[model samples]
Target chain A: MSPVLEVRGLTAGYGSLTVLRDVGLTVGEGEIVVVLGANGAGKTTTLRALSGLIPAQGSVVLSGTELLGRKADARARLGLGHAPEGRGTFTDLTVDENLRMGGLRLPRNELPAALDQAYGLFPQLTPLRDRAAGRLSGGEQQMLTVARALMARPRLLLLDEPSMGLAPQITANLFAELRRVNAESGTAMLLVEQNAAAALTIAHHGHVLESGHIVLSGTGSQLAGNPSVRRAYLGV
Target chain B: MALFLQRLIDGIGNGMLYGAVALALVLIYRATGMVNFAQGEMAMFCTFITWKLADHEFGLGLPIVAGIAGGVIFGFLFGAALERVVIRPFESADHLRQMIVTLGLFLAINALAAWIFTADTQRLASPFPSGALRLGGVSVSYHQLGVIAVLLVMALALRELFGRTRLGLAIRGASMNPESSRLLGVDVSRMLMIGWGLSAAIGALAGALVAPAVFVSPGMMQTLLLYGFAAAVLGGFDSAPGALVGGVMVGVVQAMVSGYVPAVGTQLQLATAFALILMVLLVRPQGLFGRVSVERV
Candidate 1:
């Protein structure tokens, strides 16, 4: 099957400082691709470039459409959703408003159903719907970012470090929810993560990003068992 | 007692107008993190447009309501156009430059209005029926009550816009976090432009409403702008409800100080508003209704 997202020779960075260099990857329909990297390994930059939050070079095509030259909002409308690094939740807004903004392009009639699905997956959000998102726990905020990205009902969702500052148990729970979302909705995901063990648990395929280059690629089970991955990331 | 009550009502009526302009200040600040120093001048220009529509110059001699409506529509377009032409160019520049640009706008608009309106103080007719309603001991002018009513409706409409509608959500979202709003398919630039347009329209309404009492002229808003700034700072820079409450308090304080304090009566009434602003800045920088943003690393 054709990949939902295809990137070739992707390079992006802040002005005068290149972070990603000639990186290439793909995620098939309903697949979860986890990118494992250490701090400053260009993981967040990759996601930012894909989301058009910053400038980038090379090719990023989503479901056969070239996304280069499109602005961030236009890319979002074209069905590419990114739950950015640091959660990026509208902290002052109520949980309900945050979720509504997530599916901003959805038809008015479809909003209720989309909201219901989000609330159902993260039942913890139901009670806090009226509360501001900033008041939520870190884990809940992570869930909110993920659920918000789902609001767009994108063909491919890009997540930057969903496990940042989250407890192990919470991280496990988040990955489980992500798996369920993929299974049910057939949505593809490109997950950027530092937590190797938890990320690989739900990922079907994995790539290791080392200094803006993809150093290794394999199935999730293979990478989880790899000696290099275990030494550098898994800490096994 | 009747005299005291009358002053109090008058203060509130004027306060609401100040609050209207202050609301525009707050909206622009929240959206762009920059204050439009030219806001008062923009309102002054729109008020002139309002006056022209009502005057026989155009020979239409439309009524006050239609004139105000024309002012509002013109204000909206003019505001949007200004953002695109003047502010959008320096969008990425430093905040100091942005302030300078607005200052330039202030002088240009003020001068333009003087040249066009010819420095004349025109009598802008009041849409409200003249006379007063006597209730028990206190009497209130219909014009004063009308100003209060208009401000109340504006506050409610603004509340509804921010709280209920999708467009409002987009604006609020853009103001709070432009980057996130963009990620969510909201055109942040477009939202900012709309914010300017809406704010200018509100300012026009305030100017038109107060013109009859103050007289419509190029420099009429100069003194009122100080009061409006004081009201905005007193209420907090980011809160709408705070703007209204702050405006009323500033108005009441001025009235009370001028009336009760012998020295401040007429000559130093403006001083009272200025003093209140200084005290608020020194003591509680966040203002009454503004949140003290705590950043968690």
Candidate 2:
């Protein structure tokens, strides 16, 4: 089977600063791939390039469909959900409205059902549905972002820093929830996490990135066991 | 006291007209996040279109109502086309540049109106009844009440449309996050066009309504635009209710202030709106309804 997403030599960045340089990675269908990196290592840039949020050079293909030059929204309509850094929820909008926006890729008739599924995935969002997204706690907002993306029924979820700044308990819960989502829906997720040990625990494949390039790639277990990976990222 | 009620009615009549214009400003701001400084000029220009259709000089043989309907249609199409051709190209540009473009439009449209209409104020007839209704000691013209009623309906319709409809959801969604909206297959550019279209159409109606009161002149709405902008800012640039309240409050206070304060003559009336805007901005930078956004670093 073809990989759900293929990134080959993808290089992109902000103006005058190249954050992602010739990065290569792939997430096979129904697999959770983790891109583990320290801060400013271009992990976020990799996702931004893949989702067409920034100018990118090189190939980013989804099931052989070229997505290198398409718009961020166009890529989204094609089932690439970007849970950007800071969760990128519409702060002024109600939780329900935020999720509905996520389902903009879905048909109007199907939106209610999809929203229901999002609420089902993250039951904490049910009560906050009528409240502004800004009112939610960070962990709640993060869950809302993930749930909102899932409303589109995206084939690949590009989640950036899902565990960032959350309490350790909340981080553990988020990882468990993400694992459940992948297992139940067979969703292909490319998670960028700072917490490498927790990330490798759930990720099927792990790629360690440094300065915009993938410095190491192997099964999660292999990277977790690698002394260098343990020292630099996992802190084992 | 009786004269006060009558003055209040007159103030409300003017306020509702200003409110419609302010609502237009709010609508465009909600969609584009930039105030259309030329909103009044655009409305006035369309009012001239109405005048051209109704005038015996360049008579299209259409009645006043038909001319108004035509003006609305033209306003919608004109706004959409202008946005597509002029504004869309500069969407990612700075706010100052955006404001300047609208200001440029203000001058262009004003000059165009002057060239066409000869800078003379023309009397336009009101479609509403001319008879006055006496409540206690105050006399209220049917036209004044008509303006208020129409303004209320337009406000309600807009509120409902933006808050309840699927298209509205998309518009709010797109305005909040254009990138994400596109991901969901919403045509953000098209929505921006629709936003401008809707705003200018309302503005046209306001122009037509107030034309009867103020006498249609090429520069008629310049003072009115100041009030509208003030109302928009005071009410929060994005809140419809804020616009309405601010418009009416400014109108009534201006009338009352000019009337009560002997030194504050009609000449000083225009300054009050600007002064109020400064106070509001200084006191609460976000305006009354604008929720201050907190950025998570």
Candidate 3:
């Protein structure tokens, strides 16, 4: 498949601190692309930059749509869903209301079907739908965060950290569902993760980052089996 | 016994008005995290507009009812303009600076009102019809009943607007998380402006309604705003329901204290709110309805 998104020489940071520089990548349509890095390595910045949270100098084109200068909401209106690092769930809002904010760009009539689909992916979210998102368990909140993003019916799903603090079993389940999301919806994803072994396990393409620039780029399995990666990152 | 009942009723009436203004303060805090010290003054400013519109000569000569309708629209527009022109630039300023800024805005508006309206304490006839309904032992005047009715209606409309409607939901969501809400297609700046505008309009209702009973003047709302601020804190800064309940309770307390406790005269009314603040802060800093939010690693 041709690339659904193309990023070249992406450079972003907050105020004065530069977190990402000279970073480049491409995401094929319906592909699961992962960015694996240690803490504070500009992984979250990449996602934020793409979704218009941080101003950046680079080309962030989703099917040729320029996303760099747009406001966060305007970018969202163009179908980019970002589940920020630590899930940023509205603490006071109910799970139902939290999800409602995701698809704020869609017509009102489409909300029910989108909600039903979201609830299907994470059945546990259904019972706590009425409860405030803040009261949810860590794992449950993570799921809610992801589900909330899906409400936008995004063409590109940018996940900051999907496996953070999740149980191994739940993490596995989440990865499986993510794969399914890409497969079923034809949605492209740029997932950032600190869990190198786990992220490389699911992504079709993988890029390893250290101090901002992409140091290694290859197929997921190739990166996973690399001896250098195993010795340094995979903790083999 | 009749005198006691009468004081109690009057206290409750005043409390609701205080609550109305307090609710405005709370609304501003929730959306922008700043208190509009001039909340009462803004109400006074808008009420003057109502007074002008009701004028027979240079004015539109509209009926009192028409004057009120005009006041509501003008209040909204003026509020939105103040927010956009004044409050918007101060968004990045620290809380203390913001507080001082709003205080300045309040003083400026008050000065303008005094200059235009001539600082005279103008008598404003009751917008609502004047009458009292007797139910067995107690009598309820239309003025008090009218205030209560208006407060209730305003509360319900606010609840529905913020909780259920799209515009309201967007505003609610936007304030709670500006970054995420913006990405979700909400214009955070515009949303904040709308909130200030709505809060201003609500304040106009209270000021205009009370103009007749209290008399309209630039400094008329100084004391009332304090009561409202105290009520908002007592209720929880972010909880609208708390502001309402706390307002009514505070009003009733003031009335009862004036009646039962001879020491708590007009001078001591302000003291009552300060006392409430001390007691509430000692007990529940989150106020009545606010929940403490815990952050996780």
For all predicted structures, in order, the TM-scores are 0.95, 0.93, 0.95
Q: Please report the TM-score between candidate 3 and the true structure.
A: 0.95
Residue-level lDDT tens digits of model 2 in B211-239: 98788888889889998988887888888
lDDT of 3: 0.85
True contacts kept of each: 0.55, 0.38, 0.55
User: Could you tell me how far off, in angstroms, the CA of residue A170 lies in candidate 2 after the best superposition?
Assistant: 1.3
Kindly report, for each predicted structure in the order presented, the TM-score of its chain A compared with the true chain A: 0.97, 0.96, 0.96
Q: Please state the Cα-based DockQ of model 2 relative to the true two-chain complex.
A: 0.44
Error of 2 at A73 (Å): 1.4
Worst 10 residues of 3 chain B by lDDT: B288-297
TM-score of chain A of 3: 0.96
> Which residue ranges in model 2 land beyond 4 Å of their true spot?
B180-185, B282-288, B294-297
Chain B TM-score, model 3, reads: 0.95
Please give, for residues A1-236, the per-residue lDDT of candidate 1 as tens digits. Answer: 78899999999999999999999999999999999999999999999999899999999999999998999999998889889877599888888999999977899999999999999988989999988888888778888888998999988999999998888887888899899999999999999999999999999999999999999999999999999999999897
Residue-level error in angstroms, candidate 3, position A28: 2.2
If the candidates were sorted by their TM-score against the true structure, best first, what order would they fall in?
1, 3, 2
Give the alpha carbon lDDT tens digit for every residue of B158-253 in model 3.
777767877877787887888888767788899889988888888888888788888888988888898897788888888787888889888988
Better of 1 and 2 by TM-score: 1
**Highest DockQ model number:** 1
Expressed as tens digits, the lDDT of each residue in B38-105 for candidate 1 is: 99999999999998889776425999899999999999998889988999898778779999999999
